[model samples]
Target chain A: MLRLQSVRKHYDTFDLDCSLEVKPGMITGFIGANGAGKSTTFKAILNLIRIDGGEITVFGKPHTQITAKDREMIGVVLSDSGFSGYLTVNDVAAVMRQMYPLFDRADFMERCRQFGIPEKKKIKEFSTGMRAKLKLIAAMSHGARLLVLDEPTSGLDVAAREELLALLQDYLEEQEERSVLISSHISGDLEKFCDDIYMISDGKTILHEETGVLLDEYGILKVDETQYHALDQTYFKWRRKESFGYSVLTDQRSFYLENYPDVVTEKSGIDDILLMAIKGERL
Target chain B: MRGMLVKDFRLLLMQKQFFVVIVAVSVFMIASGQNTSFIVTYCTAMGMFFSVSSIAYDEFENGYAFLFTLPVSRRGYVAEKYLFGILCTGITWLLSVVCCGIYEQIVRPASDPAEQVLITAISGLVLFVPLAVMIPFRLKFGADRGRIVMMIVTALLFGLIFLVAKAADSFPVLKQAVRAVNGLSGPALSGVAFVFAVLAMGISAFVSIHIVEKKQF
Candidate 1:
């Protein structure tokens, strides 16, 4: 379990103010556009970079109080960085064996083999997909209870992404109280994997709800200019202008459908939700 | 700390060909009866740069951001660097000593004075290495920035020496102090140098740890 409470890190042009939680046995996803503070929140959570203000806790321990032994249960994968590119799979295995007292070498090697990674080949020569897989392999093989993955699905093919999601599912099924906090640009993957999704924009959480609730309740109502002029804006989350009408995004699909009997209400996808949240004006 | 050291070792492993080239050059020098002390010095210097290279490698693509995400603490990272510097320097010194020793036995017998100087240099490596590495690390100077910082440091040293020389010329006590240092016996001078080097290295390690603590990443 992980909790970030009002975490804030300052920058000249960008700032991160995040608060979220990864409950036990749940996969929580942070969805954002580029520079939406996803990676910054991850860094602050891990204490890789210091925060200006706020608290981060893992397994009920503050980040400061968390010891190396405690970190044994935390596994991480970063999109911008990883194991040194010059190292081979075997060399990384050796490093991991030294790093984690309970490192499963056989399991690691077997996963590498299954992933089609060459033991002798340096990671620098590995393809983008291979490197991503290698990172996942390292994270998953260590029996970590908390997996914090930033852009874990990047550079992976569609099938590979599905396989990775399945692996994560199996991991949770195998262990009780396991938690994962993953960030990705790919909304579909997040839609498929996350129990709860948080939409971030301009360094703030604009939307947070269960995936099923979002899909079942959230809708876009398309009305012509004349109809839009008569519709109440308070009922919608945000409305985007179209050539002939306005498409209103709202979580209360029944309200719009019941109130405006002629308005077209369609189930909103994650992509549409993100776009409206980011680009549409606030009420 | 052990994990970080292993990572550095694996980084150096990437340069296996570079080590081969070093071996080839050393052999050519010994066979040609060239000054092999240069080789030893080169190898020692290589060790220093190699340690620096490891730090630079760690910073490559902001890799430390990921590395610290693991269990290792910042103090642990700094401690690991110091140990790795000593290890690399010691290994290079031992390799050079063995090769140079073989050359002495088979080709040119090492003179007493020359051997003594070589022994001193080899032993000084332990003190020299950590200082060399710690300062660069404290400054957080990457490989390219290291050269620039080195130039700036050299200029500052030159300026300090110039001011001291002027003071010595102007003041009788300064001249006397210089003479007193020059008049020390060999053993006493060696003792002074050893003590100074140890003190400097101790300060370097302390300062480097402070720098790491102050650092955000």
Candidate 2:
């Protein structure tokens, strides 16, 4: 449903050069650290910031060519952006109901209640988690076909985050055409719901693969000194030394298992992959 | 477009200054006992300032980003601002004229000069064209910087007008040209001036929209 073709943006200190495509009915998790070009990519797609090169298309039309009606199909949630501090949650709901044609007033109010956001309380008075919930309510209540969220769960507590995720899952089950591109530093949240994961660092995408496939393809190997020395250099991503052995990350887990049956093998997580990738020790 | 307008109006309603200004204008009109023409001119000037301040508020509040994300185009956003300014000026002018007419009816009880009132209101509305043209440019730039630029431009224009008037007093050719221009009176002059003012405003709105469209949020 969305395509970013050879996108390149340059600044004095950073350069973002990546290409990505998001298909319908899939949740694409954009994982990156702060200043890792995740927000920059989102802004580029929304045209909030001008692009230095390449093109972005949504629903088969270039972003520039898409009319206002085309925009109605997409909902965006910036990390800390929304109504001014002076406005209340109800005020935001009223404004959004007019701003979006498909905005569901009943759903918005119900979500606000469910999220424990006071309807009449000023936004400035609300906690950070409540504010984030208000933005989520606005974005989801619009019946948008595509959701582009930047750290939507950042400020939420455990319960609020779980509720928000459940709400998203419900929305996903209701419509097969709906999709989401969520960027977050928290791997656990994405792990729970994301179908595909895209790991970006230093302004470039390091990996893009299905979550389950990634889990199957990469393994962490715990080896004794003898086995570690005998292992080929190409198979190890990085090694952490213990008193008796070293732990290594390898793509060819079966080969390692066959070679050394006594050595331990464990599934790798997103955080572990990101650490290895950032250290330039990918296997 | 209607949605944009409604949202803007709602936000504007939240601003206490708008209501304060309305009350202050109403009280000042009551106290000054001014002529209808003066009231019309005063209201137009106030409306211009109000519109400029509204634009500044929108920027300061980060309202543009939210508005842009909605189903509103850059062109529509610019157009609606200009339209709202025009509508505000029109409403203020109408209210001033009506209040003055009622006052005059109570004070004079016999005079019926509808044509004169209409002419004065139209002329006051025409004067707003230059203001409308200048305020959007102010908004495109930083509002504070735009205000400084506006002040400098206004000073320069006044100085130029004074120099031209002094020169015309001494120069026979310039005096003749001034006299020739002033010879046309009544509705004909007013009509021509109004047309030129509208054309200028249209050009300004188009230019402002182009500038805004090219701007990155």
Candidate 3:
């Protein structure tokens, strides 16, 4: 539903030059470290900040061409910011009623009640977690087909995170045309939820692949220094030196296991793959 | 845009102290008052500034980031602010004028109540709406530096007026122009002021839309 082509934005301390896509009926994950241009990319996509270069489109139309009517189809949640604190739950619903023609007030109130949010209390008096949850609920309560969530699960507790992720799964399952593009620090959740994952570093897209292919095929080879030197460096995708031994991340796990049975080959998760990709040396 | 106004109106209603101050000031001005115009002036000014307070709340605690993420355009947001401000300033202006008229009829009869009401309403229409619209537009700092910006703008405008008057004393042409304007009929003066206020409001809204669209959250 969303496509970014050579999207670039320059800041004083950091810059973004990344390209990625979120296909329909999929949950595409954006994984990166803090200040790694993840949020900047999100901002640029929304046109909250002006981009220096490249094109961004939502549902085939350029972001600039997207009108208020077009924007109704997309929902966005920024982790670092939120709605006015002085507003109450009722007031927020009232606002939604006016903004969206299809705003489901009953469903929104039901979700709020299920989430234990009080209707009369001003949101300013709410705790950090509560305020963050309010934003999430507001985003989902509207009948939006595309959700662009930046660090969506960061503010929640473990159970709340699970619930939110579950809701996202249900949302995707409900329709084939629906899609989500989310960035989060919780790699484990991304592993569980994302169909395709994109790893960004230093404001660039370094890797993109299917989550299953990455987890099932990609492997790490742990070996001692002497053994590492003796082996073929040509085969290892990237190698990292540790105090005990050198760890190599490789896409050819089967080859490593078949040829070099002695070298410790273990299944690699998204985090492990990303860290090695960021810090390890390439062939 | 309607959503933005919904949010702003809710914020405005939460100010209990502001309401209390308005009622207290109106009572004092009417009870032991010199003129009912004071009540109209005070209320109109209060309404104009109160419209800005909604912006303050919206920008407080990094609210604008989330605000713009909603399905509204930046220009729509600006237009909504102008509309909301006009609504608020209009309400207060009307309420103040009606209340003053009532006080004049019941508490103290004015020599010419109709003329008084006309002047009060016309002054409010010509002065308060443009001030309310433009001042909020110029306040880049939203809530934090809003008062400071308002004060600076007001001071500069008065300074400019003073300089023009001082120059008119030395320049016969300037003096003649000023005299000609002053010598116009009452209705003609009001019409000129009305057109000036409308033009000023339009320009303010146009500039505000440009600035707000370029603003980075």
Q: Pick the candidate with the highest DockQ.
A: 3
Once model 1 is optimally superposed onto the true structure by TM-score, how far is the C-alpha of residue A128 displaced, in angstroms? 1.2
* Among all candidates shown, the one with the greatest lDDT: 3
Which interface RMSD values do the candidates have, in the order shown? Answer: 1.2, 2.1, 0.9
Given candidate 3, what's the lDDT at residue B15? 93
lDDT (10s digit) by residue, model 3, range A160-233: 88987887787778777889999999999999999999999999998899999899889999999888887766
Q: Compare candidates 1 and 2 on DockQ and give the better one.
A: 1
Residue A282, model 3, lDDT: 69
In model 3, how large is the Cα lDDT of residue B79? Answer: 85
Q: On residues B168-203, what C-alpha lDDT tens digit does candidate 1 reach at each position?
A: 999999999899878986566666767776676677
Candidate 2 residue spans exceeding 4 A from truth? A84-86, A122-125, A221-229, A233-248, A252-258, A261-266, B110-112, B167-183
Residue range B43-150, candidate 2, lDDT tens digits: 666766666666665675465665677778888888878877777676767777776778778887787767657566566657667666675667677688888888
Better-scoring candidate (TM-score), 1 or 3: 3
Alpha-carbon runs more than 4 Å astray in model 1: A225-235, A258-260, B28-39, B101-123, B126-130, B133-139, B158-191
lDDT for model 1: 0.82
Q: True contacts preserved, each candidate?
A: 0.72, 0.42, 0.82
Q: Which 10-residue span in candidate 1 chain A carries the lowest summed lDDT?
A: A228-237
